[model samples]
Target chain A: MTLVDTLQTSFKAVLSYRLRSLLIILAMALGVAAVVMLTALGDGARNYVINQFSSIGTNLLVVLPGRAETSGSFLGAVLGQTPRDLTLKDAQLIGRLPQVRRYAPLNVGEAELSAANRLRAVTVLGSNANLIPIRHMKLAQGSFMAQGAGSNAQIVLGAKIAKEFFPRTQAVGQRIRLGDSRFLVSGVLMSQGETMGFNTDEIVIIPIDYAQTMFNTTSLFRILIEAKSHSEIEPAKQAVLAAMKQSHDGEEDITVITQDAILSTFDRILQALTMAVAGIAAISLIVAGILVMNVMLVAVSQRTAEIGLLKAIGATSADIRRLFFAEAVLLSMAGAILGFLLGQCGSLMLRLAFPQLPAWPPAWATITGIMVALTTGVLASILPASKAAKLDAVNALGKK
Target chain B: MIRLTAITRTFHMGEQAVYALNDINLQIASGEYVSIMGPSGSGKSTLLNILGLLDKPDSGCYELDEKRVTDLSETEQAQIRREKIGFVFQSFHLVPRLTAAENIELPLTLSGIPSEQRQIRVNEALQAFELKQRAQHRPAELSGGQRQRVAIARATIMQPSVILADEPTGNLDHQIGAEVMTLLENLHHRGTTLIVVTHDRELGARAHRQIGMRDGKILTDHTDDAG
Candidate 1:
């Protein structure tokens, strides 16, 4: 028979069993939809992380104190037997490197900020004047603390903190008590939003010297570094690591992180997540494919007499096989189309709910969804098609 | 012409072997109208199936137009069946999904005949069977008589040399059965060989020649040329 005739016959036959056909298509569609949505989510998460990192500038690095190495077991370190100290002297030495543009030593502690009758628990950040250049901080009123303020007790309130402590009054030049000490609010910072899970807009900033005295600590907890240029970031990070190693008696007691390393780690994590999600989606697709095979087998059994009549009239085994294969492919393609549309709708719904989310359903993901659907359909139809082709015409004709 | 010598067809029933057709010898000339009469399990249908190339005899030397068809492979037999023989089943096995015209064109289409020629042949068959008005109706939509006519039209559209009808009118009423038998006889009159398998003696006696079969073997072969 001509291809057109075979296709028409197959289509008509499938349509005759509308409910079964629809159920099979729906199964395939759901599989494709799952694959599309999962991959889209993975892509969206990766994009969100990359965008977050890019917003903070790629020419930046972070330095944090690492656990002190000892000639003992990990349990000993976990039991607080290890020394914990990252001194300002190391920060000063790193800042003096030629590749470093500027650096800020930070000490973080939670404290209650009280002004007039209002009081709020806030994260207190201790840093020097270099923090303004290292973080690219902007000002809403007044100015950042002067370099000399590192020795005197002066403070800069973040946007949200200023609004809470001095709602109807100017925050600058007002005195706010932090813990047991008082510092003049020299400026109100512009809203810097959240970064890496921490809201910079919700903190109060004071000089590193004042924070050390107020919290009664002598060690730096974190250090922020800026490169002279984008090309210098890696070199500056290496310089900081080398200096910290030398100062800490050859132990890797300080962790130096560059933007490239952070991004590569994040990329690796996202790649693994995407693969896992895709693997799960593939399992669902296989299930859908098996469903197709099962339905086709049932169809073959139900249409044995029809197959016998066609064979008796001179249809070859290959012809019968092609007819069933075409039927399967048509069902799968239809399901893929419907699934892609449904997935697109699902993504759009997610976007509507979370407008700030990154774009979902990357082009490759959509194409992969189609390929997965087609592959599942073809693979699932194979057994049934072969069985139909191999059916004995005489025996089939004899059946009721 | 068709020839059968020492043709034996057997079936396995559990642990026992039953002979459906046993050492049957027969010859049928082209343009001849013949019917075989038998009770149930008398091998009449088995003989017809062997002649139609739809079944193979366990032991046989059968010749169709001097070709040793018994030795031919299944595919080769199928080719011969498609090109040289037509079949009309007792149940009028018309494909339910196809219209009357499409069903009539089935053999032609299967043989890869060009579409334009297939269409011509189908139209001619429809006109000859007086089914042109109902050509578009599916098998389920067609009445018993119309469906039988469509089946006959499909059988003859290929212009094969021989037509095998296994109780062609078994499912029809007397009037429609007579009409269908007349259609088969008309094909025989047009210089094609026709073989009918029937249980009804009246239908069997209507043919120019009648063969009576019993117990898997032919008991009598009689001719009514004088009638």
Candidate 2:
């Protein structure tokens, strides 16, 4: 038969059982829609994480005073104990390394900042003047500490810290106590918001010297390093690692982490998680495939007499098989179209619900969804098509 | 013209072999109206099926128009069935989902006839069968006579050389059965071979020649004019 006539005949037969056809299409649509939406969510989350890492200066490096060991039995590194004496002198030595544009020795401690009767627990950060530009901090009022202000007991309060401690009053030029040592508020920092749940504007920044003396410890918690350019970040990291290796006598007591490496590791972890979720979602597609097979089997049984009559009227086995295959393909194509539209709408709704979330559905994902639907439909129709093609005309006719 | 020599057909019910047609020898010329009459299990339908190329004979040399069709492949037989033979079943075998027009156009469509020409043939068949008013109705919605008319229209739409009617009126009333037989005979008069398989003696006797069978063998082959 002509392809048009065959398709017309198949479509008429399918429509004769309208509710059953619709149910099969709906099942397929749900399967495809689930895959699309879940994969889109995974893409969005991965993009959001990458964007978060990029928000911090891409040329920045974080140095932690610890050793990571790789051994034979484990096949991976175990974290060694950190050296408790990472002082400002070490920070200066690292800063003097070639390719190190600037470095900030940071000491982190928890304390209460009190103004009149208002007191709140806040993270206190001790760093040099380089911390302002190196960490991309900005000022809301007054100014950051100068080079010698570390010995003068002056501090810069973050925007939220200042707002909480000195609500109606100007935080700059006021005194705030950090564990019995009162420091002048030299500047109020601009709001840098939060990353991964750590609020940047809720901390107080002081100079490195005074913080070491006040906290009664010489250990530096972290050191922030900025490179001269994007291309120099790796060179700077290697230089700092070499310096630390020399200083620690080849003990590998410090880690130099580049922002790119951190972002890539985060991306890899998120990608694995997304793939795991998508794999689970694929189970529904398998179920849909089975449903297609079952429905096609039922359809073959229901149309047995029609198949017999067609054969008796000179329809080739190939023709009968092609007609049934076309029916499956048409059903799947309809489902795919519906699923694509529904998935797009669902993703859009998610974007609207969570405006801060990023959306990045890759082109291959949509193509995969379409191909998967089509494959499922074709695979599901094979048994039924073969059965229909192989039916005995006399027996099938006698069945009715 | 058609010829059959020593045509033997067997069916296997488990380990036992049941012969449906046994050493059947017959010759029918073009435009001949022949009726196959037999009681149940007497091989009338089997003979008609073999004649129409719908079934294969086990040890036979069957020729149609001087071409041996008994040994042809299944596909070749199907091609011959499509090109030379049309079938009308007792149940009508009309596709219930298709309209009368669509049903009549089915054979032409399968033969790759273009839609425009198929439409013309379908219209002609509908007019010839006096089913034009019911052309759009599905088989389920049509009366038995109307459905049989549609079936006959479909079977003859391609103008095949022979028409095989297997109890064509078995499910119809007497008057409707007569009308259907008249339609088949009229097609026979127009130079097409007509073969009818039936158990009704009155209907069988109406044909130009009747072949009666018993115990898988032909008992009598008589010309109606002689009778």
Q: Pick the candidate with the highest DockQ.
A: 2
lDDT of 1 at A203: 89
How many clashing residue pairs, candidate 2? 0
Residues B24-138 of candidate 2: C-alpha lDDT, one tens digit per residue: 8899999899999989999988888788776778898999999998888767777787889999999998888789998898889888889999988898888889999999999
What are the iRMS values of all candidates?
1.9, 1.4
Tell me the spans in candidate 2 whose CA falls farther than 4 Å from its real position. A70-84, A112-118, A129-154, A165-187, A228-233, A248-251, A359-362
Kindly list the per-residue Cα lDDT of model 1 for residues A1-400, writing each as its tens digit: 6888777767877787789889988988888888778878787788788877766654789887764446654333345443557888888998899998888999999999898988889999999887866776777887667755446677888899898888888999999899989988898889988877878789888889888887898988888888899889888988888888888888656667787778878988986897688779878878888888999999899889878777776677887898899899888888888888888888788778877676488787788878988998998898999899888877887776
lDDT of 1 at A249: 84
Q: For model 1, what is the C-alpha lDDT against the true structure?
A: 0.85
Fill in the DockQ of model 1.
0.44
lDDT of 1 by residue, B13-65 (tens): 99999999999999998888899999999999889888987778889899999
Measured with C-alpha atoms, the lDDT of residue A157 in candidate 2 is: 89
- Per candidate, native contacts kept equal 0.33, 0.45
> Scoring each candidate complex against the real one, what DockQ results?
0.44, 0.55
Candidate number with greatest TM-score: 2
